[model samples]
Target: MGNALRFLYGQCCSEPPTTTTTYGGAGDQQLGHHGVSSTSVGVSALAQHLYHFEITSQVPEGLSKHVSSSKKAQSNWYKKLSKAWRESKPPPKTPEEASRLVIRTLQRHQRPDIEVDARAVADGDTVTVYVSTSDAPESSRVPQEVHMAAVERNEARAHKNYTKADALQKQIKDAGYGVLHINNEEILARKYRIRLRGIDAPESAMPYGKEAKDELVKIIDGKCLKILIFDEDQYGRFVGDIYCNGIFVQELMLKKGLAWHYTAYDKRPELEKWEKSARAKRIGLWASSNPEMPWEWRKNRREHR
Candidate 1:
């Protein structure tokens, strides 16, 4: 099953879009490249076999006709399909119903996007998440065997069966999954460190730094975040925008004056607007006549050291 999903994901990536998106902002912005095309991944036979409908570019009727052959289009389709699949309670009763659902979902998202789950916050602008094998839209469901293995490993450790536990751990790692513990609950997940895009907050020792961290924790703690990854930084942290319950996390921080818009790396007009609003109101760090930038603080600390 793992191999099959990998093969299908490769099929999604094998073809590039006819056109690439250009970012006029600062630094290099890496948008959604990790995407899957539902139309090409064995969807035709499923539609035909189950719905008695032939989905092809030649025939071009129903869902097939509307979907673009481009990779970007397919990626967007998959993101919508993923959201729909999660929201669908009774699931689709028939192939026609499923096809209709796909059509509806495809209409909403026109841009490329990537997604991940947040597990912990390092500060106001950095977080840790787990990206397991199931993060892919093609394989939204985690393999049952992996879950069982995790449970078994825990039992083995409890029983002092170190050898057995080690073997099971190896199996889990080989399958691209890791064992995680959150509030004493054992979880199977992968670790991903992410840096919030377009904003830089104060360091821990800086003014309002603790407040900034606390506010971030308050907003995201125990809540699943929808992260749109843009790029990866030198420290191996993914840089992205975080959305919690449809609220833009970065916007809140900037508007509250907890963070500064890192204009050198990001040129989002909204980020600049939010920061300006906070500054005008003298909120958070903006209350200081001359707040030291986190970058500058880090530089001074380095020089002193």
Candidate 2:
């Protein structure tokens, strides 16, 4: 029976080893069993066939169903994730809009407000800006009217009406503003509280420094000075060359020797040449045998102090 069972099991498992068994009694009589036995030993074969049939019939359908469901679930999950990502992202802002937002934020933080208003003057070479506090009264804002006045003055200057032009220039200067004549045709003027450029003068002294200031004043104080703005100093003041009546103030001062060439900041290539010429001619401060450069004087004074 065991051998027959083994044979049946082998056949059920697709081809197995053949088995043969011999039973011997005490009297030396032998009983040999061969071929398949007519016993219930083939149960394992039936069970194995049933198991294989069940798996073959149901496994494909189960796999197909599972794959379809998993595909649908992944599609839905990806759709939801993409939708959420779009909702969470913010739109990009334009440059102008972003600048406005920044300004508003700064204002909210109690920062000082700066406003620029540009107006075209008649001559086409100038623009004017009137600056005033945000809380200033409407009547106190002078930028618009000043720009128009500057345009009128530029027209007058162009026509050689020096008297009228001078009067307007004085009015503008008295109002604490500077007028820029652009290409002798247009005007860009602004009302700004700024110190005079280059030379530092005392309130009262030998009037030498004041004389330098006055010379600058006579040339550029009331007339339309062409401003060549280069850069701003650490103090936020505009470091520029002032051209008065077509004269370079830096060169003028250097020629007269009234002012030493400010080599540290004034980087005009022609400065050294001008200084040499002035020294050879023995002009202004260079008239002295040992006239000290202003920078060296300032340094020495500071060190002594």
Candidate 3:
């Protein structure tokens, strides 16, 4: 069951992901070739079979026929398909619904689809979840197994159970998300997707990347950040402008030379000035005699692979 869930949540994404998004601004800057496509995995057929999605939509009768497989036609078809999917059904609105959608991602060519019965139990290293093609009436409540875990965590806190709280926190993190403590008042857990805006941090495997991430962690590891979401990216991450204790996150990263100014998407002159100062001062990655940009690195990596 654990393996099943893992596959559903992760394994089906085998394709080289790409997303071409043009940033609309004064110059109509094309995005850096670094964007990722949607995170939802699996083929359209498999996904539809598992999620009850339909591919056919009223894309004008002869709209596709006249195009003859041209690039422009492909783009139009993609937009039409995306629009159809959006208009067909609303996105998952609750945690349980979202989880169900994720679990259905497990259906692929190599694996059989499982039924969702809203029953899952976890004992030691063993986890058992009932699967059926026919879903039971959608339950507003979290699955019993997950709910029990949440209850245990709450009970631990009530008794000042540091050991239990710490353990449960690890468990939650292992399951793909983190726990948030609210003003020392309540335990909060929810799915979230926040991408720091106006700058791109180096991947952890790159030079000074760990330092950049570590600095971010230092700034807000145990605190809530003020986030203003501007939009959602194709990958479903929130394109958010974040602040730490009133300090703009992008500005600070620029000052430290920990991130790129993300000129492809943002064109603020102040940000460019900060990047210039960091470069002149030879701080962080700028200290390197020659540092490779993350976008270029990713591009090269993909090409070589």
Candidate 4:
């Protein structure tokens, strides 16, 4: 009995019993021996037990699939959402992109289409972007009208119709205006006197003073001129240069010795040459042995008064 018990114990504890039957007792007892025991199971049964425990204690297949699918859908949704958000934002820092945005906004406003050269815009200032239609009318070009009038006068003078030309001159003088004839078709007239650059013609008729005025009238009587208005003088006359078809009227008068320049008001440094030429030629007031500058003559007259 002791030996039999030891054999049964060895069969159960050894690697595995290779034999199909064990020497227990007989038919019923043999059935008992064949019954299932913990140590006597096959490899398939052991694998099934491990699989069952894993299913119960660990994660399920259905739950893991659902979780992975949810994560993937969330990642895709976030990518699309970020892309849509970026579309409405301001442009990047590049100059070309920024300029395009500015120009588009400006075009929406009704402003002038003046080509803006490259410039930096300040913060908070309103920028102009559109074309404007409020420009001066074509028929209202003042300079062009003056030029045409000058041409008509010149044509009259050229045909030796002195009466008509003289009448025009008188009309111009009476109107407190000067005429500029530009080319044969353009004339300009303004009801103002531009101080002749480099020379001052006297207001009253002194010796050679009327002659100076007459010379100026002859040269610019019916010409078109560009008047650049500077400041006004104490006498309320606008002091500026008269450009006849772009020629400086003052330079021509000075070259002809028709006028003497007032040095205090004439800023041209080159007038010294003209002065020398005038003195050498004995022109205008220079003909007198003691010719007085208009300012000095006025000062002396004031003192005598």
Candidate 5:
């Protein structure tokens, strides 16, 4: 009886035996025996937990979809920023300049369909433009006094002192520089005198001169312009093509008979065509049988002077 009791005690303390079993296919999972034993159940659960961990390890469980989206957005922004940096002439000089450039580029990207603005119209064939400080070339040199005035004006404005800011701004403007508020941002700009290319208008005292100037003003006043600079004239004016609201300025002047094609300087056939059209229609200066050429009038005036 004592020997039988010892054998029963040994059986109760011993672990249950496990049997290996092959699944349907050779590549399929091989598991332990499907017996009603604690060891087999624990072995199956462990395999399941490990399989789940392998899948989840590739991408952690706690991360959200927002993180992936943010990374994609950052990559897109980096691509655009790189392109803008390459195209930027005289690249950024400081952290502030870089920030401003990024902001301006993004704004332009957002409103690519809109037109840009010009400063003012000087005459029938001349325009005044303001180049923003951010767009200024590296070699551009601003007068020390003008730069100082600009700095002080910015500070004054920041402190809510409009009177002082206005005075400082006036001084800056007197020095041939100006601060323009574009898109609700303050931009310091340099002045440029631009002469319209491919056409010549009458002098202020000549026939239809006032009419030509008035017509140009009527078409471009308070409107933005796109200028393509060619060369600088002897009068320190930039000779360039001017487009206002998508209309070629020289073409308008020629079509209206307010200007001569100035074939000696510009040989574009389009200018000649427009002038001939206006002449045939007897528009503006064309109403006179023989209007004096502006160059001849200027030469005579110079000789008299």
Candidate 6:
């Protein structure tokens, strides 16, 4: 049971969602009028690793094939759920449908050799699961191979052996999973912070910075978020695509000119369309005569310090 959980913690957090929607009514509401910046000042107060992925490897050849097959089935279920969310839209009905979809996924996952125990955690909405071998009465609750793999993986991470960590990360990803946390470090579901991929907004102190965050808060504060991490930035933040209730938040940010397309890192050439539109419309940050990019601004701040 423990081994399977460790593996899951490493491989499952979220996936990129499809389509997009906007919470347009937000502008009328006076949320955080004092407009204190949260992304850097108050936010940087809490320390975080720039990047991390969690998962265990080392399943044997025969069993690994089975596991991979199971993962494909799981992925299909998740994709369908995402599609439904986008098609049906968010709200009173969406939540019920989403929950039922999850149950359906679990039911579909039933297998004779595995007993899947899943329950809601006290911390928040995330549901954790335990997978035990039920092939034989004498079998260990946590498969022996998975347990040993986790042990080795943890030892490598403890020694700062990132080479092993990277290899293990690749193994986990290839096997169709994403690690949400490592070693039980984050005790709360809210600690699962995801950064917007393909773009970076100005710091809180910078021009329009507060506006960007305010827009984000309006859009995602209560919406279900899906993140697909492609890589991690130097700051240790997971660099990934963010979907808020099936809407592509990054694209919206660009549409509003609330963020700069982080070309050096993500290189989303298509984002130029939204950026051009925002510039023509003189929206948000583009309202400034000559606004500084967040990357250059951060560099200047560091050099001055």
Predictions ranked by TM-score, top down? 5, 1, 3, 6, 4, 2
Q: Model 6: per-residue lDDT, tens digit, 1-305?
A: 22222222222212222212233376643211012112222111110100110012222222222232233332343344334333433311222333453345344443322111112111111112222232223224434444334344544666889899667655543433333332232100112234667777878788787677777766555445556668765755556776656888788888988888878776667787788899999999899889998889889899994
RMSD for each of the candidates:
16.6, 36.1, 23.8, 40.1, 23.5, 23.6
Q: Per-residue lDDT for 110-205 in model 2, tens only?
A: 311222222321111112233222223322454554544555675576588999988977877776555543222122333532323443322212
Give lDDT per model, in order.
0.62, 0.41, 0.49, 0.42, 0.61, 0.45
lDDT of 4 at 7: 20
Model 5 score (lDDT): 0.61
| lDDT measured at residue 64 in model 5 versus the true structure, 0 to 100 | 15
lDDT: the better of candidates 2 and 4: 4
Task: Please give, for residues 1-305, the per-residue lDDT of candidate 3 as tens digits.
Answer: 22333332243223222334455685664432222112332332223322221244323322222211222323333343334334434544333443455454322211111211112111111112222211222112234444345446655765899899788767755654333332232222334456776787777678887787766665554433566778877876667776656788778888898888878887889989998999999998899989888778878899995
Candidate 6 or 3, higher lDDT = 3
Our tally of clashes for model 4 stands at 20
**lDDT, candidate 4, 1-305, per-residue tens:** 11111221222123332333334556433211213232333322222222333345422222211121122222332233223223425422232332343334323432221211112111111011111111233113334333344445555765889988778766654544343322222122334433544466544446666666666655554444555556677765566666656777676666666566668876676666776687798876678887666667678788995
Model 3: clashing residue pairs? 115-131, 115-132, 116-132
Q: What TM-score, computed on C-alpha atoms, does each candidate reach?
A: 0.54, 0.35, 0.43, 0.38, 0.57, 0.41
Candidate 3 ranges with C-alpha deviation above 4 Å = 1-186
Query: Where does model 1 exceed 4 Å of error?
Result: 1-119, 135-177, 180-187
- Indicate whether candidate 1 or candidate 3 has the larger lDDT: 1
Shift in Å, residue 124, candidate 5: 1.3
lDDT string, candidate 5, 1-305, tens digits: 11111211222113233434565687665543221123344333322222333444322122111121122222333345446655666544333444565556545533111122333655568767776543325114666677567666765766899999899978988877777655444555677888899999988789999888888877776666777899999999999997877898889999999999998899999999999999999999999999999999999999995
